[model samples]
Target: QEVVKRTPGEAEFHQAVREVIDSLGPVLVKYPEFGEAKIIRRICEPERQLIFRVAWQDDKGEVHINRGLRVQFNSALGPYKGGLRFHPSVYLGIIKFLGFEQIFKNALTGLPMGGAKGGSDFDPKGKSDNEVMRFCQSFMTELWRIIGEHTDVPAGDIGVGGREIGYLFGQYKRLTNKFEAGVITGKGLNYGGAQVRTEATGYGCVYFVNEMLASRKEGFKGKKVVISGSGNVAIYTHEKVTQLGGKVMAMSDSNGVIYDKHGINLDTVKLLKEVQRRRLKDYREYHRSAQYTPNGNIWDIPCDVAFPSATENEITGKDAKKLVKNGCIAVGEGANM
Candidate 1:
């Protein structure tokens, strides 16, 4: 209640805080010092937040402006390390929610990193390559003043991927006059990017689910899986799951969902999404027998394993109920979108 009162109108951020606080009830009781120090209150507030205007020209040479922000939420552990999301839905509350979660998530890793998140409300979809590059240039023009190799490192999230990262990194290099590869990640392999970085999240999700299954004396062999989003995470998850003997029947995007009862072909998916940057509808062009439902719920399909690699809050109560009714035994958040 106090947190919500302090941060009014940020319902999502308040909810995130409440969820963590509720889980920490036992911990607070055990360690009264946390309450004494008012650590929770401090954690709720950001260390620094920079909000700037990102103005760029479109393909028609028409100038437009959008809000850009970066939130450095915590640094008690180490330097801030997180991803920069670019999407039409990004806002301060959403960024704060993600950053606040990142703090504890980083702490759990025992890594040399704290927590931060940055992004813009600009939609990269349907934009020309030149327009995207120009937008990235404008975005980094201001962001470069705050980030560094040993200070804050940013990667990709949601709309920000290899293409976006390359543009941002190129602009950073041009502005800073140095090739600091460590300042950003998700770079192309021609540079210093890790080969597994693209596959890590998808593969990591499968591994986590595998561990859970292993604990119960089960595995991915012959399990029916449905993964949302045909992006890097979903495609790689499909690949890895298929390799592990799981049958992936469905994948989706913001537009719609595609259900292939015969299972997805990884090579075709990769060529369509990764190489051509086409939508999930294009998947049907190759697999004419598969079904594509526009703006449909992927969860409605029956499955044993469900991996959501799409947006936040995509699986609502009704969706969960559908998944439960369909006998879904395991669900993994394979990507943050």
Candidate 2:
């Protein structure tokens, strides 16, 4: 309550803190030393928050400016590590919320990386390749000064992906005159990108769900699954689920969901999305029988497993009810919240 009152206008951040605190009553009771040290209060405050102006030109040569931020929330574990999301909804509140959560998530991973997040309210959708390149270069011009592999490594998230990473890394290399591959994680394969990194998130999610199911003596083989989002995580999740013999019935994007009862054609989807950078509606172009539903109920579609691989808060109470009603037994979140 005090945090919410103090940080007015950061509704998301406030909610995140409240949820975390509510779940930690047992921890505080067991570890009085942590409570006495005011660890929660200290973690609420960020060590450094950088906000700057990012100006870039579209193909029309018109200049536009947006705000960029990097909230280094905590470095208790190690160097600040997180992703850079490019979306119109990004702001201080969202960044703070993500950074705060990353602190605990990193600790759980048993990795040396700490917690931080940076982003801008720059929508990449409908932008031309050249325009996106210009934006990434301009964004990285200022970002390169503060980021290093050993200091803070930023990767892709949301609207940012391989193309954006390539542009950002190229700009960073031009400015620093060094081929430091460690400065970023999601680079092109020819440029020191990690092996299987493209599908790691989705694969990790599938592996996690498999473990959960195995504990109950079940598996994805022959199970029906529906995944939201057509991005890297969602596409790869679909691929892995199909490989595991599960039928992926549908996938979605901001525009809408793509339903294919006969199972999604992963090859066409990958070509359309990853290579062509087209929208979900284009999926029907290749598969004549595939259905494209704009603003339809993705959860209403029946499935044994559901992967919310899209943005945050996409699945509402109504969607949850529909999923439960339709007998969705498992759900894996590929998106970081």
Candidate 3:
């Protein structure tokens, strides 16, 4: 395990990695076979971590330089697999957490994949489509050399979606001149994307919850569910819950949450998220009766089931207590914790 501390600023991330490694030492010693196989020690560190400078010109013709990283953690089972996140909050600590979690999650899937994660701290919220494409192209220009179909495969995460992936894949293909289908996942359907890939995560959560309910002799029929976050996961989770006969009472984002006690209109929620790409605050304008609580807590609202499909740590122990007190029977987590 090679531990390279880039600078004093990366202390937090380094400390986190050290803590995780320390915790795993006991487990490694307990499983003598794993120690003999060197699996635990081998899994404690990333195989490779590439940090590069990305320079791109903004629409205003101003040159901006951003740091990018691709952490190919391990490939013990198969090729490295994870998502590429692009957000202002991205950093070494966040990426490392996601990458470490991916290692175990991929193993649980019974898939032949190891673990990796990459991204930058570039916010795409207000940027034009052209600007986003340009940035992605520039980012991929450097990233392509380090990744391939059998090397490390990256998919979509917080800020990287279809548009970003399209720009990235185009750049990769242009540079390598290789039409590799398996090099990336979460691609457009017309271009070798698997069916139900888009809705897989969100829908899978709903399906698991349904099974849990069935096991307990209960189902989603007429149940009131509260979903936080209006992104792809939240939107699709809302859709699936509705399909299962549950009425989604609310959905939220960073701006706020909108509660429709009369039952959430799935079509309207879709319009706000999919078509408009707007915040949940705008939902109240269309439906006057829907209560829009700006910057308010979604867990405060009463519901039967709670799905915190937003970012990590959004639902803390405090929020969990509130949900349990509010009669929340089941809680679903979508993001990497």
Candidate 4:
């Protein structure tokens, strides 16, 4: 109630706070000092929040404007570290919610990193390479003032990937006249990025799920998996699951779902999504047996395990019920969802 009152219209942030508060009963009871010192309250509020203007010119010489955001939620552990997402759905509430989640995520790793998130509502889907570069340059013009290797370090998320990161890093270097490779992660290997960083999130998720299944004397050797989203996480997740002997029956994009009975071909998916940036519907051209359903409910497909590796709040109550009814034995989240 207090969260909602303080941050009206920020439903995602409110829900994030409520989720943490609701889970703290045991910790509050055991420590009591945390509550007495108002640590929870401090954690709920961001250390700093910056919303800025990102104005760039399109190919047609028309100027477009977008709002960029960075919420330095907490730095109790160390410097702020998080990804910068570029999506039309991004807002203050979504970034706050993501930053809130990042605090615990970093803490769990016991890494000397804090929590922060930065992004803009810019959609880079149809933009040309030069247009994307101009946008990154304009964005970094303002962003460079606040970020550094020892301060907040931003990486790629969703619409922002290696291409975006390269452009952003180039702009950062050009602005500061310094080649500080440590200022960002997920850079191309020719730059300073660590190898396997691109596959880390997806591979790690599968490894974590493997451990969970091991606890129950089960594994992915013969499981049928359904992963939502055809982006980085989903693509690599499909790769790792297939390597682990699981048959990934379906994968989806925002527009539709692709169902392949024999299993999805990662090579073809990589070509279509990564290189060409085409839709899932084009997948049928490569594999005749593959079925593409436009705007279909992926949850309706039966599977042994489900990976909601898409956006947040994608799996609603009804979706959960449908998955259970379809005999989904486990669920592992590979995205913010």
Candidate 5:
């Protein structure tokens, strides 16, 4: 209640807080000292929040401006570490929501890293290489002052990927005049990126789900799967699931969903999304037997397992009902949703 009152209009953040607080009831009862120290209140507040203006010129010599945000939620364990998003949907509320979730996520790993999440409302979908470069440079110009190898290290998220990270890192090096490779993650392997980093999240999600299925004395072999989103997480999830003998029947993007009865071709998906940055609808060009539905709900499809790897709140009550009605035995989340 206090969180909502304090951060009015931030529905995501409020929901995140409520979820966490509700879960902590038993813990609070077990350890009243935590409540006595007001730890819960402190945890609800971010240590620092940075918001700035990112201005750059487009290819047409037109100036475009966007808001950049960084919420350093906590650093009790170690330095601040999180991903930098670049989707137009990014805002303080979503950033805070994600960062708050990160606090628990990092803690679960038992790693010496804190929680933070930063991003801008800039959409990189249609931007040219030069335009993206310029926007990244401008975004980093303000971002670099507060981030460092030992302070806040950011990785890729959503609209921010290898290309955007390269531009941001280049600008950071230019500003600081130091080859601080540890200042960021998800760099190109030639520079300092770790191998398996690109496939880790997606692969890990499938691996975790495989274990969950194992608990029920089942596996991914011959299981029909439907994954939402064709981005990094969904693409690799499909690949790993297929390698484990699961058939991925559907994958989606923001525009629509693609259903392929013969199983989705990961190679074609990579070509369209990773190489060409095209929409999932173009998938029909390669697989003539596949079906494409514009703005369709992937949950409508029948599957043994469903993976929501797209944006937040993508699976609604109706979608959940349909998935349950379609015989979906399991649902794994590969995105923050």
Candidate 6:
């Protein structure tokens, strides 16, 4: 039925869907139970796709508008679960990829969740806090009606964080007139958020590496590590790595990388990232001992471990080869690789 509905202009979309469906053909052929389950025939189509216009007022009192989307791809296994990204790079294609990937990721986690994703093309950077709050509230106003604890649960991703989640959840509660604790997962601790939830992804990566090393009677103790990005994952990764007795050689942002061979002072990194909300380039002004390599490649630095805690495809085949050649024994992907 989905194939019959495809048109020539949707050629690219059809091709992508077909590729995924084709990949499942082998599995269905190998397992008669999967065929009995009718999984292959239902592989590519999304359960629901929502597109809405988000209009809000800027700090200047100028009316601004943007498109918002929520692709609730599948919910056969459980309720919808994914992140809300806000960036100019967002589009239907990108949201589909993210939602599709979340299905398998959730399955692997052994959590009661199915695939879904949502976001807008609105960039939160350089905007006033009030402006951001207004945008988040507007986004949530439409989104809350379709999501809930047992229905759908959204979390933080990319441009969405504690601030964004706060505004979103506040708006949700105000509109629904109900305080559902599990409606969102990344809320502040005082508001029923789990401890270490913010650091879960990064810290879990380190923990997995530690376990793998223990299996081989090795560890990260006294080893030099280089981590990319200055977000929550990167900042917390630097913290856990240093706590486990490893020196983080460098950290980077989209603009460039910062090389601090002595060690990336965790507190100072947090100050530059969390407190100041500035770019990684600003780290140099405070910690002069740390070498600031503007617009540089972080993988070029020598290290025993490498954590790419940034965006998708940030580390390519060439970056992998460089890490291997530089003697990096362990690599972790905090976000999409």
**Best TM-score among the predictions, by candidate number:** 5
Cα TM-score per model: 0.97, 0.97, 0.91, 0.98, 0.99, 0.90
* C-alpha lDDT values of all predictions: 0.89, 0.90, 0.84, 0.92, 0.94, 0.83
For candidate 5, give the lDDT.
Answer: 0.94
The C-alpha stretches of model 5 lying farther than 4 A from their native spots are: none
**For every candidate structure, what is the RMSD over all alpha carbons to the true structure, in angstroms?**
1.3, 1.2, 2.9, 1.1, 0.8, 3.1
Count of clashes, each model: 1, 0, 0, 0, 0, 0
Better of 2 and 3 by TM-score: 2
Model 3: runs farther than 4 Å from truth? 1-30, 36-38
Candidate 2, residues 155-193: lDDT per residue as tens digits? 888888999999999999999999999989899889999
Clash pairs detected, candidate 4:
none
lDDT of 4 by residue, 1-337 (tens): 8778888999888888898899999999999999899998899899999999999999999999999999999989988999999999999999999999999998999888999999999998879889989998899999998889898889989899899999999999998999999999999999999999999989999998989999999999999999999999999999999999999999999889999999989999999988998888899999999999999988999999999998888789999999999999889899984
Ranking of predictions according to lDDT: 5, 4, 2, 1, 3, 6
Predicted model with the maximum lDDT: 5
TM-score of the candidate numbered 1?
0.97
User: In candidate 6, which residue ranges exceed 4 Å CA deviation?
Assistant: 1-26, 35-38
lDDT of 3 by residue, 117-194 (tens): 999998878777888888999999999998888999999988787888888998989999998888888889888778
Predicted structure 1: clash tally: 1
Give the winner by TM-score: 4 or 5. 5
Question: Looking at model 3, which ten-residue stretch has the lowest summed lDDT?
Answer: 1-10
